[model samples]
Target: NSSVSCHIVQVFSNSDEALINKKLPKELLLRIFSFLDVVTLCRCAQVSKAWNVLALDGSNWQKIDLFNFQTDIEGRVVENISKRCGGFLRQLSLRGCLSVADASMKTFAQNCRNIEHLNLNGCTKITDSTCISLSKFCSKLRQLDLTSCVSITNHALKALSEGCRMLENLNLSWCDQITSDGIEALSRGCTSLRALFLRGCTQLDDAALKHLQKHCPELMTINMQSCTMLYPSCSKSQMTALWFVCLAAATSQITHTHTESFIHIACVFLRILEAARCSHVTDAGFTVLARNCHDLEKMDLEECILVTDNTLVQLSIHCPRLQALSLSHCELITDDGIRHLSSSVCGQERLQVVELDNCPLITDITLEHLKSCQHLERIELYDCQQVTRAGIKRIRGLIFNFIGCCVILGVNCVLFC
Candidate 1:
């Protein structure tokens, strides 16, 4: 009799739980749904009134990650959300969303004034109008990532320069449309800028960087990866052509060939050439560079087809304060250059990160000598055809095979990571 009563009680409890789920209040459901993603939260509006209120809550609408949203849908959603809940928003990521027009961006800029981080990567539709509005409203913005946003011209950047004076980390990678005027504006306006990325922005030449060095004295880290223009080819003729290109590109007017030539020669020694996609940068150009920027601490000669081990030898000897070095895809660099690097005074103390990617000339012998480097932290030898298993094994042993460090245990200090 007792066992039968217990079974009946279990069935009643199961039915009661189902009844509670079915009769749950809409407000309670919405309150519980506040922690969902934007997509999921928007869908919860179909559930009931309480769910709708929760979805529309100003606090819950602060962060908007529209990376996966459809462009047209994103525009409509942003319009609705901006009307209802833009005041409390702190972070907005519109990465790769193309439908965000000037109007929608303006709405965000005006309404979401407290935004801290704004990522607009690959949003090619944004023009100077968008930036102008952001400047007028988003004053407290700290981290702004504008990577690959090619449509943003100088006028919009100038607006940002005047507006976001307190900006810290600003990424303009692949913004090929930006020129010296934009950089000059930034240097004059946002003097507090710290970290800046100009990767693949090939049009930024030495004039802009020199201006930045003059004004933005507080700048700490500047990633100039693939900015071929800054590392211009060292020659009177090349410099003349480069200046002509810069002038013509900036003013939309052609320059006199003779005047360009004269200026090129006058500024030849002042230039610090980068070996990025410049096939003409040979040993001769490096000789000029060595004479010019003897204080150069960071050098990257990636894909510089003309650079040889002879140039590296000279660079290691001359650039004694060199800290970070990238010689990736320079086929001419060999064990001779590596040996010179290992024996170099610069290589022993200051060198931190060395990228020898795809250089078939490097071998196990290079690894053996790299162990001498004390400050060396990151070493990228990705796809080096000559690097064998034995070389990597030796590297692993050096980083991990410490006998006296047995008490310290599992601290693998391999340079690759």
Candidate 2:
């Protein structure tokens, strides 16, 4: 009996020894470490020397998201990560990291040469030097967000265009210093670009847009909110030249007109356009956009004082895929415009959200026209003084089949049913 017990104990000891000596593959270890957060990984580094090396391995740190540690992400921490990651880092987001300056960016640029996605939004201290460093080193970069980085100038854009040829999505929103020259350079160089955000970039004008039209034939989304300088105005000479070209093409042959039209249509691929508060954009400019960008899905023309019912008519006719539209503060839009929109095939089928905030001319009849918008989900009628409680109740019942109760302008009214 003692011999049998000894044999069993020996077998169990051998099994335990084999299990203790088992070594996991390095790739498996790195994959396991990748699941841990930065804080947890730092803690794991203290477990042992092997664990420390594995925790700081470059393969495991390919995509570092330090957005959660925005306030705590200082230059030192960024420098340490950059040093550890080496060139394997593919994505790094330091959004709202106020403490991160040019030094941290320089560290990243020097080490992470293969970085493709970078978000430095609201990093106020980063300047043109950082851009130069990124452009020089990270040639494979694809998406860069420099939103509210006010210090960056045209030099940064020029560097990006010259070096980062693969850039696709760029957000220069609130970078106030960039002008048509920088934009022209970007359009000329970055032909693969798809989406561009230039909100509050007040220095840009129609010439920059013309450059984009000529160069960025694949552009899908462009946001120029508050870029008041980009007015859609063509000189008489330009208009005459365009008309003469069209006429010549038409008179040359039937195939010539078709070829010219095809080229014009193929150049514009804009899907989403936001030009809110661009007070300079009139009927002429809006018409140009409507004629070119017929595939528009979402459009914001809020506070565009020059846009009247004519613009709506054009949009209703051309933009068949338009789902979300904001015409807020466009006082010129009356019941006629709403009627035209509601009566349109696209409006009845695709129209979803409509904002008419502070539109003084809109009356109760606008709601009656909107009843035809079967797919309409939400509509804002804030400060439309002409709409009465009776009209609101009537429309609420007609549309929603439920009575909506709300207070607007000190009167009990149905806002949206």
- List per-prediction Cα lDDT, in the order shown: 0.66, 0.75
What are the per-residue Cα lDDT tens digits for candidate 1 across 340-400? Answer: 8767887887777678877889887887777666677667677777877567666657754
Pairs with steric clashes in candidate 2:
none
lDDT of 2 by residue, 165-267 (tens): 9999999989999999999999899978777888778888767766766677666556665665654333221111111011111111222223223325333
Angstrom error at residue 92, model 2: 0.7
Q: Which regions in candidate 1 have their CA more than 4 angstroms from the true location? A: 1-36, 43-48, 200-202, 225-228, 231-300, 304-326, 336-364, 367-417
* Candidate 1, lDDT over the whole model: 0.66
**Candidate 2: deviation at residue 354, Å?**
1.6
